[model samples]
Every structure is written in structure tokens, then in C-alpha cells.
Target chain A: MIINARYIAFWGCTIPALQPYVEKAARLVFGELGITLAEPEGMTCCPDPDITHMASHEYWLITAARNLALAERRGLDLMTPCNGCFFTFTEAISELKRNGKKANAVLSENFNMTFKGKVRVYHALEVLYDVVGPENIKAKFTRSLNGLRVTIHPGCKLLKYEEKRLDVKLYELTKLTGSTILTYGLERLCCGVPLMYLDADKAIELRTKPKLDRMKEVNPDAIVVICPACHNQLEKGQLMISEDEEYDIPVISLLELLALCMGFSPDDIGMYLHRIPADDALEKLGLI
Target chain B: MNEIHPLRKRFRSLPSSFKGLLRSELRIGHIYELTDLTVSDREDLGLPSKPPTAYSDPNALEALKRIAKATNLKKDTGFDVDKLDFEW
Candidate 1:
């Protein structure tokens, strides 16, 4: 696979701060695919659509524009692993196109930077499924997760973009691993990471519990997720409710799974960093 | 989220998400900061102790700070970026 696509790797706040394991796996997997991930120099948070936008939409717009400008200067599109960052950057680009005149003025006056709207944003899921192609991915895998059963959790933000519905992309990419994706009725449901800000208990009972319960019935080996926020909510939410029932389903990132099959050791990707141990799933992969 | 409804009236006080925003602004110029343990973990994984983002780059952090001040983010959020340090 001679994929010549190169983009600025947007390691959003969560990956570096809370989910370095995902970063480790992504570096390994993307490297193997012949994809070049250039790190953007002055990148900040996508400024967080949920939090920053709530406090002040104007600030959110400007901060996101600054990040976008960094990529535009480099003449490369920005690609992020976080669904929220993807949603934020995509929506920011659209909003800027409509009202970027004022933003460009502020950017020029403050930092002498202007987001000329030259850059495009991509989620790693789209890059893998569309650009790299699943056949190329399958060709690179040294072993297949033939009998591994896992349930998919496509986070909420990725679903809202109608043009490129990433849920289907996530499903198709997971299938390339040769794992049977257990059908769960609530794949589209939000993992309730956003709601945790308002009410933690209700976020668990109303959102996380129902999804976990549904997947529990299927008795899959793991719950696979792409978003760091979803990974945090699903994995940490289980430990929060551990006193009540044992929802021991380990949450694995799609990148980590691909890295495993590509012959990287589990330890190499920081599987031990998971709040809920993925020992059961790793053992199934013969990685333990 | 603010498009759905204004968050000012939605919650009586700052939510964790709001603190997260402040943390991004005032603490490390990102949503989460790196601890010693996490830094060591990155080293073990053959990655840089700190990534090349704003938190690691002094120039980037300066740019973020300048932008935050110019945009009145502290005023809009109704908290002083210098004070009210909760270690977020």
C-alpha cells in the first residue's frame, strides 16, 4: 500500500493528557500503513465543543480558528483521533467560512495569523477506511481476530455529520479485523461523557448503564471505541458502578486492536494503562 | 451545546466541563495536564515526555495566552484567569 497521504496529526487534549495509550497505538498503526502523521507545532485543544462553546461560542470559534490556522500554514489537512475534535474542527470550518471575516481580523490583529480556510479536517477513522482502504489494512495484518466478538460504540459527535456518517465507517473498519461485531441496539447512543458535567449519577443510570447492560447480554469479549471521551466514559463508568454489578467489559480502541494484529506487543501500546484491564481480550489475541 | 440553550442559566454554578475549559486556559493551555506518572508512561511507550502541543512549546503557550486575553475569554467566562485557582 503506497498511500502517500500525509496530514498534521491533531492530538487533541484528551489523547495526550488522559489517553496516551490510544496515542501509542495510533503512532504504531498509522506508521505501518505508510501514512505520515506530522505533529502540528502550536496546537491546543479543539477548544472543546461541549465546554468552551458553552462558556462562550465566540471564544470557541476563535480558539478553533487558531488551531486551524496552524495547519493551513503548513499546507496540510488536520486529522484527529477524537470524535469531538473532528466535529469541532469540521463545524468550525463551516462557521468560519460564513463569518470568518471578523475572525480573520481578530486573528490578524492579535497574532498576525489568518485561517484562509485552506485546510480540511479528517477523523482517523475516515482516513483508515476511506483513504487507506480496508483491503490494504487487511493485507498488513499478520493475524486476524477471527473469533473475537466485540460490540461497537460509535460516539455521538461523529454521527451528527450527515455527509460522512462515520458510524458506517467505524463498523466497516472493525469488520476488517475479522472480528464478529455483536449487534447492539444502542450503538448510536451517546456514551454520556458530556452529561457528566451536569449530573454524573443520571449520566450513568440513564446513559452508560443501559448501553453496558445491552452489551452485557451479548457477552462480547470487549467494547470497542474510537473516541477518547467514549473510552473514558465506558471504561471508567464501569468502575464507578463496580460496587453494584460486575460490568467487566474492557474498552479497546480501534487503533489498539489494529496495532495488535500488526504484530506490536500489547505492552508496546500501553494496554496496561486501561482503567479496566484488557487481559481477557489480550489473552484471546494470544498477546498475553 | 450553547446553541441548544444558554449554559449560564442551565447550571447554577460551573460544571466540570466549565472547569475543564478554565483548566485549558489557565493551567497547561490544554484540557488536561501531564503528571509525572503520565510523562514516565510516555517515555516507556517511546514517545516524548511532553507532546509538541501548546503545553510543551513555550511559543505556542504564549500564543494561546495572548489569544485568550485578546478575546476576553476570562471576562466572558466570568472568572479571573489568574485567581480562583482550583488546580483544575
Candidate 2:
């Protein structure tokens, strides 16, 4: 389908600063799909999913509401690939709606602004799966990864949050590139971000490592994730673990895969930035 | 998270629902359901380590109630907070 669509690309804190390659890949893929990832000025971090929530519920709510307010003023729905940002926005919006009067009062008194909760917040996978859709995603598949086996982290915000409920679109999106999504026992575990402030070792030992250990048994070509923090955790977790001692599975984003499938070369689509090189995965698919 | 919030002290002792969501934060394990296990549960099974805590954070229920309750706008008007559980 030939048409124009626009979304306020909520880059949040991680992607632009630590993970620009994700932005590069997402841009390339979205450009190819004819979707516009608009960047409106004056938007800040989703603050954080766990940190802000734990540190100050009030400040977390206020900061997150600010980003949504900016997007709402723009009349465009917010879209983000970071599950943390997605959680912040989605959770904040939902909370604001449920308690509009009180939230508005607090926000107005402190920041001289009100959150009407008008705009919709969406994860990148949600937009791709629900808006761009599987059929269209399939139509753009120029390089097939049919034999490539991948593991999906799906991200916590998209899956577990009680209100935001999990959906199958991320699964469907991963399958669109013709890659196999390897399922394991600990597939739904956290990335250790919440405990990041409390204990780093515990986050890895308890969450990331066990899941990686189990995924090690499956021997997938790469791990696919929709969230940036999870992307960093899984990728960084491998580096933290002794590759000689554990699974050093490569991690890649959903947009990167879509870019590769849409005829973009590995280097052009920002594959080199991954901690564990995606070269092997791309070369295996003959997209090098 | 910042230094000014109340949750910093409350995090360790938050209700079971929060604890359940902490361990099963991604909802992949479903801690409240049969899928998740505690540290002792893991040890009993001969697993190497205990799971970290991080479950689905209600996403909004607590925030809504907290905000409303703070402003004295909360009402029992038959609005079930339990219905907030299925929001994904």
C-alpha cells in the first residue's frame, strides 16, 4: 500500500545517547515502509520504567506526563522501541486518564500544565504489527532469513504490565522476516533493570544469566528484542558473562531485522554497533 | 527513580502483588500463576540461583488511586479497582 503515516518517534533516553544504531535501523526500515518517524522538539526521557517509579511515584508520573503532553499537543500518537519508555508513556497515560482531576491538579500546580491524556502511546512493534502489519512487512522482504533461528525477549512493558496486557503482534512481527523465534523456559524473565539501582550482580545472576543459560541450550542465531533497555541488558549481559562459560548469543532489534529483510545491507542498517556482531547472522542469511 | 520518592523505602516491603510483578515483570513467567518460582523453589529444583524481582507494575492502578486519593477525589462509586488487573 502506498500511503503516508506519521508518528512522534519518542527516542527516550537510551536510544539516542547509547543506541543510535537502533535509530538508524528503525529509520531505514520505516523510511522503506513509507512511515514517518517525526521528532518533535522539547520531548524528554520517559524518565524510566523502574527507577523513576521506585524513587518517586509523583515525579515519575509528572515527568512521563510531560512527554505525553508534548506529543498530545502535536496531535500525533507517541511511538517508541524502548519498552521502558513505552511503559512510562503507556502507564502514565492510563494513570492520568483514570485520575484526570487529581493528576491534572498536581501537574498544573507544579508545572503549569495539564495532561488531557489525548494521544495514544505505542511500542514500535505495536505500530509495525498493528499498523504497518504482517502482510505489508512480508511484501518488503527482499532478503529471507528463513533458516535463521532467533529468540524473542518481547520486553516486559509489552507483555506483563497488568493494564497494557500482552499481544501477539511482536511474535507476528518477528516471524515476518522469516526467522524462527526460539522459545525457552525462562523466555519471559526481566532484564534486571529494576534491580539495577539495588544490585547489579543480582540482576544478572537472577534474571539475565539464567535466561541466557537456558537460551544457550537452544542455540539460536540471535536474540530479538523490541525494547532498548532489554536490548542493552541482553547484549551487555553476554559481555558480563564469560562467553567461554555461557551463551554469547547475539542480540538484535526488530527494526534491524526488518531493515535487513527489506534489502538493506548489514553495514548500512547499523549492524556493526551490536556488542555481539550481527555480521554472522546477516552473512548467514546471505545479506552481507 | 530519584532520591526524593517514597518507594525507595517501600520497595522492599511493597505488597505481594508488587513483589509478584517484580519477579515476573515481563509477565513471561507469571509469578502469581504456576509458572514462577521463589529462591527456595529454585534451590529445591537444583537451580543455580534465585530469580530477581520485577513483575508487571500494575502499569497504572496504583498511580491512579494514589493521585486521586491524594486529592480527596477517590470515590467507591462501584468502580472496581480489581478490573484494572487485565489492562494489557
Which segments of candidate 2 are over 4 A away from where they belong? A102-112, A161-167, A243-246, B1-88
Instruction: Kindly report which residue stretches of model 1 are placed more than 4 angstroms away from their true locations once superposed.
Output: B1-13, B82-88
Model 1, span A89-116: residue lDDT tens: 9989999999898778888998788999
iRMS of candidate 2, Å: 15.2
How much DockQ does model 1 earn? 0.59
Worst 10 residues of 2 chain A by lDDT: A40-49
Superposed Cα deviation of residue A227, candidate 2 (Å): 1.0
- Native contacts retained per candidate? 0.70, 0.00
What is the TM-score of each predicted model, taking all chains together?
0.94, 0.73
**lDDT, residue A281, model 1:** 84
What's model 1's overall lDDT? Answer: 0.85
Per-residue lDDT value at B32 in model 1: 79
